[model samples]
Target chain A: MHELSIALSIVEGAGEEAARRGGKVSVVHLRLGQLSGVVKDALLFSYDLACEGTLLEGSRLMIEEEPVVVFCPECAAERALASIQSFRCPVCGALTPDVVRGRELELVALELTYEQHAASATPATTD
Target chain B: MNNTPHPPRLPRLIEVRKNVLKRNDLLARKLRDRFRAASVFVASLVSSPGAGKTAFLEKTLTALRAQCRVAALVGDLATDNDAARLARAEVPVRQITTGTVCHLEAEMVERALDGWNLDELDCLFIENVGNLVCPSSYDLGEEMRLVLMSVTEGEDKPLKYPTIFNTADVAIITKIDLAAAVEFDLKSARRNIQSVRPGMRVFELSAKTGEGMDEWLRLLQSRL
Candidate 1:
């Protein structure tokens, strides 16, 4: 599906950040929202294929799933939607289209590992 | 052992906080700015295959061309048939053949718009490849997005694909002429749409029978 392309973008984004920061990427952290229209399972399946032969190969993908949150005018507070099928406020049941969150498909962070070469390691800092 | 010392590698966690679709989103923002500068109204249509998107767009182009400079860009996995069909309206129409891509990205739209003077157009319509799910995630820099569902397609269509409905600015119930024959429940359809996206503007029309076209056209013109 479109998950492959999405996974490819993830790999590309993480790879760029790793390059800039100067390290081998060990893990990619992503924030995927419920209303982002992407299936987590499908994206996970595609991630390995997208990472093949890339800088992010053999890296683990950590996904943080985000639930849809909408602002309810009646409740005067933001509410997390239990189901995307209904956009009504959980507390007041008021139908509010004001989506405060849950469209996020962001690369939040990266786990990098730096290999210390023998020549670069100082005896004082080593245990 | 050698005098050289070796230390184990340490995993460092760094915050990168970036959007996965940032590239497309940036391009879309630029396109939106360009559209605003040119004083042109851009709208994109999304619907399931066989939901009468092309027919509605053809009717729209034909009607709007008489009043203003209008054009269209249609996307499909294959075949330029949609482009040819829209060309009957006698307005400039281009087809973006995505090959295997299920949705139209901002870059494809940007490339299709090349060599066209945005200043000469009052309104532009982009007909996305007909697939409800994938198209919901991509934004093509349109000022308005209309998600269509024909009467024959069950009233629960919105409930099934709430994300697309929520992302869309307007809901269009196409093939209204066949509603009675198909036992289409207009009330239920409207309720479902509102349940997923409250305060969404909706229009019920038939591109074939010319029913309810006036109201829809009025809204389009007002947007322009």
Candidate 2:
């Protein structure tokens, strides 16, 4: 499945972010849009397999699901798009309007739990 | 050498759970950068088996070659038949024979175009391995992507495989000559396409009859 590829990108991307932050990453957060063409279960299943040994090995994936939205031209209203494109408007029985968003495929950010040692009370070198 | 009841064999465990495809995506980004630099437009075609991608390519390659330098890479699970078919149109055509994979990835595409001058061509077409589901997941660094559903394939395919429709820039309804014979509903098919891709540009054509081919070629000319 393409999920395998996407999961790989997520782990690699998060791993890069974690390395850059110089911390141990605890979670990888993503926003999955309804029309992004990625299935959540497929991505989740592949994520675990994709994150096994990298810097983000134990990091958890947090996905925020976004609903499909459509603009209704007749009513000039924004509404949820029905699954399988049941496109008749709920209000007016007309074709639903264009899709403005809901196709996002992005890695928003990373959640890291870093250990910060307290600053040394005494300087090592006496000036 | 003495073996005392062979030491318990442990499975070699490497924490290699990463996706094997990331390498390809990296290469794809490089190719995309190259494409962006050169203004080379590319598109890939995807569909189920027998969706007329080869015939469509034949017609397209012939027309596009007349106007601009065009090339194509055709993928199939077994034979090089499609490649041969398109080569007859007198353009540079090659075949990628994936023995078992359901779809084509970026690496295969990268390898196919390797050592070639990308700026020499206006548009390149990659005919995917004829799968509706798996190809939706992979991006081939193409500026445009077209997913085709033949009239013989019925109108409900867009609903069945909305994921592919969602990924495509355009949808093509092929074999319109057979639409009436197959009882294909043009209205409902267009409605279905719109429902899946909302405002997606569509082209309906038949390569055999040359019906509607002119309109499709005109769009290709605009792209080049």
Candidate 3:
């Protein structure tokens, strides 16, 4: 599944972010879109495989699904779409051509422990 | 041994707003720059299986080769069937046999063109794996992306898979010669496409009969 590739990217990105923060990530927050073409369940499954040896190993993936928004020309307003199949505006029955959101695939934040903060604050000292 | 109470370890939150496909997107942008600098026009074709994408490409390569340097990279889950079928057009064709992957990514394309000289070719065509779903998310750095839907398929194909149509530059309705036999509703197809993507360019063609090949070829040439 393409979710594996997407999961790999997320893991790699989160690992980089975690390294910059000098901590081990415990959870990764993601914003998934309805039309992003990524399956959340599949991505969650692949995330474990991607983080086997990385900084995000055993980390939880928290996904927040984004809602679809369409621009209604008849009403001249943006309306939230319940589904992609039916583009008919909520306010009016006219179909809209513009889609403003619901295509997001973003990594929003990372949860870390105090041990990670300590790791970043000081480097190993050698005699 | 003495027991002592220890303070609680706090959990910290780090904010990072980054697209999960950023790496692929960055690579695609670089590839786009490279193609632009070389003056090579790149177009990618994507469609569901048995939609006649290979046949269409074969006809296109045969016609386009008469005027300019043309080559193709075809992707499939298995077998070199498509690449072999396209090679008969008498142009360079390579098959990226992705064992199980559903879609072709930018890295696969970049790797496929490793030693090829982009300046030598006036145009390059990448025929993606026959999948309407996963391919929509991966950008292969093509200047034009064509999504094909055959008349045999339901007219609501675009509505069902709007994401693919949303990401595509043009929509090609194939197997038009059998439209009447299949009772394909042309009006509904057009309306459905419009519903998903307004003002999208559409080409109705029959690769078997070459009915609308001339206009399609002319459009490609004009774009080049």
Query: What DockQ does every candidate get?
Result: 0.68, 0.10, 0.51
Query: Model 3 RMSD to the real structure?
Result: 3.8
**Model 2 misplaced regions, further than 4 Å:** A71-78, A84-98, A114-127, B1-41, B76-81, B96-111, B137-143
lDDT (10s digit) by residue, model 2, range A1-127: 5687678878777776555545566777787777776889999999999988788787788788878777788888887766735655567766753676676666776666544331122221233
Write the residue-wise lDDT of candidate 1 on A22-127 in tens digits.
7788999999999999999999999999999999999989999999999999989999999999999999899999999999999999998876773254332343
How much is the lDDT of residue B51 in candidate 1? 100
For each candidate in turn, the TM-score is 0.95, 0.75, 0.89
Candidates' C-alpha lDDT: 0.94, 0.79, 0.89
Model 2 Cα lDDT, one tens digit per residue, B99-120: 8777898889988888779888
- What lDDT is reached at residue A8 by model 2? 80
The parts of candidate 1 lying over 4 Å away from their true place are: A116-127, B1-6
Residue B204's lDDT in candidate 1: 97
lDDT of 3 by residue, B108-185 (tens): 999999899999988999999999999989889999999999999979999989889878888999999999999999
Clashing pairs in 2: A49-B17
Sort by TM-score, top down from the best: 1, 3, 2
